[model samples]
Each structure stands twice: as C-alpha cells, then as structure tokens.
Target: MPIRLATTADLPAISAIYAFARTQMAKDNNPTQWGKSHPPLDLLKADITAKHLYVIEEAGNIGGVFAFILGEDPTYQQIDGAWLNDQPYGTIHRIAGNGKIKGTFSKALAFCEQLEPNIRIDTHQNNKRMQHLLEKNGFTYCGIILTEEQAPRLAYQK
Candidate 1:
C-alpha cells in the first residue's frame, strides 16, 4: 500500500472508510468514541487543506485515512498522567480503515515510525480494538488526555 497525502477529491472515499470504522467501533462495543458527527467532513476537509491527512491506496482504492501531524499537539500538553517522553513528537490521529484491507494501521504506524520515533496517539478508553492494535504495534500507554469535547482518551506513545 502506498501512503499519500489526501486531496479534496479523495473526501468521498475517505469518508466511506471512516464510516465503516464508525460502524465497526459500535460492533466492537465502543459506540460513543466516534458518534455520528465525529470526525466531521469539515474537519477532514481542513486536514486535507492543511496537508495533515493521508490515505493508503491499495489496488486503486483508498483503503485508509489518518492524520500524521508534526510538533506538539495542543490537546496533549496537559495529561492526567505522565508521558513516556517529553521530547518533540508527532501525533497520529483519526486513523481508520475500510475493512477491506488488512494491516492498515500497521502500515500507517510504520510510516510514522520512519518519520519519527517519538509518536503519540490517543483512543477512547472503551475502544479495546484500537488499544490492542496500539499495544501490538509497540505503543505504550501513557495516560489520559481530554479531547476538544472534554472527553477523556487514553494516550499512548512509542
């Protein structure tokens, strides 16, 4: 799979992948993490405009979407618990796959790892599936960090 920055033209396909992820989250018993309006189209559009969004294409299909943003994330500045490192880092957010492809997260993580060793990501406390994937990918639990909505998320670092 080739990872490339997302363009406005990729919105529809990106949205579809996120939609599938939302549905799968519900089925996995993590329903409230990404509600109906979570990761809104406008936000995705903004990510695209900022060049922070990316898509993994496989067989001419957009298999996944994610945000790999460099520098310190404002939301992560204050953590309820401690972080693994206080050095400069990049954040991985809004990572979702179309379910049609396997190793999507792994591939994305590999890309991020290549870019920088100090990578951070967060997921809902109830998002067991994501937690497992993060740990499996060599991320260690850091602590809780609140999102823009004031919802607490489990932070991780590698």
Candidate 2:
C-alpha cells in the first residue's frame, strides 16, 4: 500500500473508519475515548489543511489514516511515566483504520521508512488491538499521556 497525504475530500472515508473505531472502543468499555467523539470532523479538517494527515491506499481505495506533529506533545509532556527515549522526534497521532482492509498497522509502520528513528505515538488505554500491534511491530511501551479530554492514554515509541 502507498501512503500519501490526505485531503479534505477524504473526510467521508476517514469518518467511516472512526465509526468502526468507536465500535471497537465501546466493546472495550472505553466510553470516554473515540467512543465519545467520533468522526472528529473539525479536527480532521484542521489536520487536512495543516497537511498533517496521511492515507494508505491500494487499488484506488483508502485503507488507513495517520496524523503526526513535531515538537512536544503537550499531552505527552505531562505524562506520569518516563519516555523510552528523551531524544527529539516526530509524534504520530490518531492512526485510524477501516476494518474494510487489513495491513493498516504495517502500512503505518512503513511511514517510519521516511523519517528519523525516534517516532512517538499513543493509544487509548482500552485500545488493546493497537497496543498489541505497536508492540508486535517493534514499538516499545514508553508511558502514558493525558488527552485534552483528560483521559489517560498508553504511549509508545520506536
């Protein structure tokens, strides 16, 4: 799958993936995470315009999405746990995936090939699937970060 920057026009697809993510979060009883605010339409649009969204595509279909930012992740900076590495690095945020296709994690990991080594990311405490995926794909459990909503999230880096 090829990963490219996503546009505002991709909102529908991205929203659909968030809906799927909500279902998963609900099943895990994480009612405060993506389960609470889905589609994140406004945030989506903002990220798109900032040129921070990335999409994985194959056969003309979008499969996964990721957004990242540089500098200190405010949420991350306040974490109670220690970071695996203190080195400055890019922070990968909101990696949403549509169950419509597999290999989303692999596609996300491939993003690493384009940048520096110390990449950071976080997952909902209840997002077991993502936690496992990150671990399985070489991400080390770093610590936890509190979201703007005041929810604690498990953090990782690779």
Candidate 3:
C-alpha cells in the first residue's frame, strides 16, 4: 500500500473510515476516546490543507487515514512521565483504518519513520488495541498527557 497526501477530494472516504473507526472503538470498549465525532470535518480539512493528512490507498480504495505532524505538539508540553528523548519528533494523530485492512498502524509508522525516526503518539486509556499496537511497534509508554479537553491520554514515544 502506498501512502499519499490527502486532498479535499478524499474527505468523503476519510470521513467514512473515521466513522467506522468510532463504532469499532466503542465496541472495543473505548467509546469515549472519539465520542461521536473525534476528528471533526473542519479539523480534518485543516489537516489536508496543511499537508499533514495522509491516506493509505489500495487498489484505488482508501483504507486508512492519519495525520503526521512534524514538530512539538502543544498537548505534549507536560507529562507525568518523561519522554524517551528530547530529539525533534513527529506526532501521529487521528490514525484510523477501515476494518478490511490489516497492518495499517505498522504501515503508517513506517511511513512516518521515513520522515523522522522519532515519533510520538497518544491514546485513551481504554484504547487497549492501540496500546498493544504501539507497544508491539516499540513505542515506549512515556506518560500521561492531557488533551486540550483536559482528558488524560497515555502518551508513547519511539
């Protein structure tokens, strides 16, 4: 699968993927992470406009979407646990995949690594699947970081 920068044309498919992901998360016991609408349309549009959104395409179909922003994330400014390093890193956010695809996380991580070796991510405490994937991919649990909403997330870095 090849990852490409998302365009406004990709909005519909991206929205669908996220919608499915939200349902899946709820079923997986992580309902509150995204709630009804995690990554709002306007924010996703902003991500696309900023060239920070990417999608995994397979056979002309979009299977996954994510935001890879290179730089510090304001939410990560403070942590109850220390980061692995102080090196410049990229943050992976709003990563979601349609249930039809496997290895979406691995593929996305590889793509981000090509741009920057150090990567940071966060997940709601109940997001066990994501926690497992991140740990399996060598992402160390850095600590608790609060979202803009003041909700604490489990932060990880690689």
Candidate 4:
C-alpha cells in the first residue's frame, strides 16, 4: 500500500472507511468514541482542503485514511500529565481502516515518523484497541487531554 494526500475524489471511500471503523468500535465495546457521525463529511472535506488528510491505497482503492497535522494541537495544549518532550511534533487524528487491510495504524505511524520523529495522539479511554496499538508501537502514556468537545481522552507520545 502507498500513502498519499487525499483529494475530494476520495471522500466517498474515506467516509465509508470511517463508517466501518465506527461499527468496529461498537462491536469492540468502544461505541461512544466516534458515536454515529464522527469525522463528519464537512470535517473530512476540510481536512482534504487543508491538505492534512491522507489515504492508504491498495489495488487502486482506498484502504485507510488519516489526518497528519504537523503543528501544535489546541486540545493538546493542556494535559493532566506531562508530555515526553516539548519539541515540535505531529498529531495523528481521524485514523481509520476499511477492514480490507490490516496494519493501517502501523503504516500511518511509519509514514508520519518519516516526517516527524515526535508524534502525539489521543484516544477515548474506552478505545482499548487503540491503546494497545499505541503501547505496542512504543508510544508512552502522556496524560489526559480534553478534546475540543471537552471530552477527556488518554494522550500518548513517542
């Protein structure tokens, strides 16, 4: 699979991937993280227009999507726990797979790492799968950070 910036043409596939991810989360007992309409079409469109959205393509189809923003995230400004470092970092958000391919997170992480060694991510406390993946990938628990919606999420850095 190859990762590349997403364009408007990828919206339908991206939306489908998120929908599948939401269902998977529900089955995994982590329903509320994305709820029913997270990463809404408008937000995803904004990400694409902003050039922050990327898609993993396999066999000419999109298998995964994610947002890689290289800058400080307002939600990460205040944390109940400290970060690994104060250095410049990238934030990975809205990562989801369409179930056709595995290792989406690992592939995304590797791609992001090539750009910035320091990366930050946050997940809902109930998202055990995400937490495990983060831990397994050498990410350390940083602390709790509230999302823009004021929902608390477990933060991590690597």
- Output the worst ten-in-a-row residue range by lDDT, candidate 1: 29-38
Clashing residue pairs in candidate 1 are none
Whole-model Cα lDDT per candidate?
0.92, 0.79, 0.97, 0.96
Clash count, predicted structure 1: 0
- Tens digits of per-residue lDDT for model 3, 1-158: 98999999999999999999999999999999999988999999999999999999989999999999999999999999999999999999999999899999999999999999999999999999999999999999989999999999999999
> Backbone collision count in every prediction?
0, 0, 0, 0
- Tell me the lDDT of model 3 at 141: 97
Query: Which sections of candidate 3 miss by over 4 Å?
Result: none
lDDT of 4 by residue, 21-121 (tens): 99999999999999999988999989999999999999999999999999999999999999999999999999999998989999999999999999999
- Candidate 2 lDDT (Cα, 0 to 1): 0.79
> How high is each candidate's TM-score?
0.97, 0.89, 0.99, 0.99
On lDDT, the leading prediction is 3
Better of 2 and 3 by TM-score: 3
Q: Write the per-residue lDDT of candidate 2 for residues 1-158, one digit (tens) a residue.
A: 88888998888887777777787778877766665576478888988898888888878888788886766778777777788777888888878777777878777767854665688888878778878898988988877788888877888888
- Say which prediction, candidate 1 or candidate 2, comes out ahead on lDDT: 1
